[model samples]
Target: MPSTKIGILETGGPPRELAERFGDYAAMMRRMLGEGYAYATYDVADALPATPEEQDAYIVTGSPAGVYEDHAWIEQLIGWLRQAKGRAKLVGICFGHQVMAEAFGGRVAQSDKGWGIGLHRYQLHERTEWMDHAAAIAIPVSHQDQIVELPPFSRIVGGSDFCRVGILAYEDQPAISFQCHPEFEPAFAKALIEARRDRLPDPDAAIASLDQPDDRERVAGWIRRFLDGLAAERS
Candidate 1:
């Protein structure tokens, strides 16, 4: 009956100018996770712990950096994940998702299709006990890199035409990942799209996509259930 300890591996952040104006990624996560659980953020981009026993479960945050980048902390995180080897529950989002896929023998690369910035829908092809619904879920997205080849142990549970490997779960590992940003609220998502409007290949389209309603809280609820389920399994 104790509170769950969740380790948040902070990878990267938005522009300092924007973060000062709109809050950082960790703040969004704290809002999504609410008050029941305790979160300890290890700025993995800056430093990783000497041991993985720091928390009961782990959730890697999305990063602007690519998994293919030659960052020391990224490599270190991958090594830590290799060591974890299903010892604890690990949930990944966006860049975190890509890194987990890469660490587990999958391939991640910049897509030829260009930036995926905006609201997108993914069909839930398979359902786990953690999922409250099997219908499509709409979430904000902002990545061009994707998981093209999955690890042998991974199963594709959800996807869309925009991203084939939208969601993945490992058969042999206590892990799950989503390609979209469920932690992103409407205001943040709009600001992010506006912040990088010129850089995007289709900024107008991206802006237009924001017209759709978001289901951020719903996805966050499912993620909470998933983490709780992971805890229950070991208990």
Candidate 2:
């Protein structure tokens, strides 16, 4: 069989200094995803894919910006996602997750809970075969926004008190998204916390939490198995 074509729809990236050390968000995702598949990246600030359906699947990367921000490219990306739904599989992370929810009749905004850093745990509500039947998970997270309202036909995969819409799977679409960052290595997660020390309420605590065992590979497994399902279906 041929390699699956995976597109990286990048909306934002790490700080320039941190990126030099940890690689950009796309690179981090690629490392987590491993090899054997082909990848194409589109910097959404520059442009979205001319053909949304060209890739067998797309993994939307985390961004520093909010989904409600008035950016032309951000709006365009949402429109493209609407067109791409069901045409190709999508896996959204952080901002990607928020944007997908906003595009699909949901709402996203800065959480009153403030910044959520470190490894946050979520109770899995329901599991599909692709999820490997996991009932709970704790993955790296760095965000101030989350999906507050769910889209129609959305199924809850997992959630926690801090972020109710942490993980979601659509009933009528071949798509799923997570508010956590499975792509973040412990080092990168720590560095990100340190970089934003001024903005975070408890950077030291957040950085300390990174030392605990996390479910990075566990979430990555869910993503890999979920995406691998697309290979057999794609032409």
Candidate number of the best lDDT: 2
C-alpha lDDT of residue 40 in model 2 = 92
Q: Put down candidate 2 lDDT per residue, 128-221, tens digits, no spaces.
A: 7776656688788999997888999887789899988999998888889999999999999999999989889889988889999988997888
TM-score of every candidate relative to the true structure: 0.94, 0.96
lDDT of each: 0.85, 0.89
Kindly give the stretch of ten consecutive residues in candidate 2 with the minimal lDDT sum: 226-235
Quote the lDDT for 192 in model 2: 91
Where does the lowest 10-residue lDDT sum fall in candidate 1?
226-235
Backbone collision count in every prediction? 0, 0
Query: Which candidate comes out best when scored by TM-score?
Result: 2
1-235 in candidate 1: lDDT tens per residue? 8888888888988888779976788877888889989888889877775666677778889998999999888888999888876777889999989999989999999999889988999888977777765478888898999999997799998889989999898999889999999988777777888888878877777777877888888778878988887322211
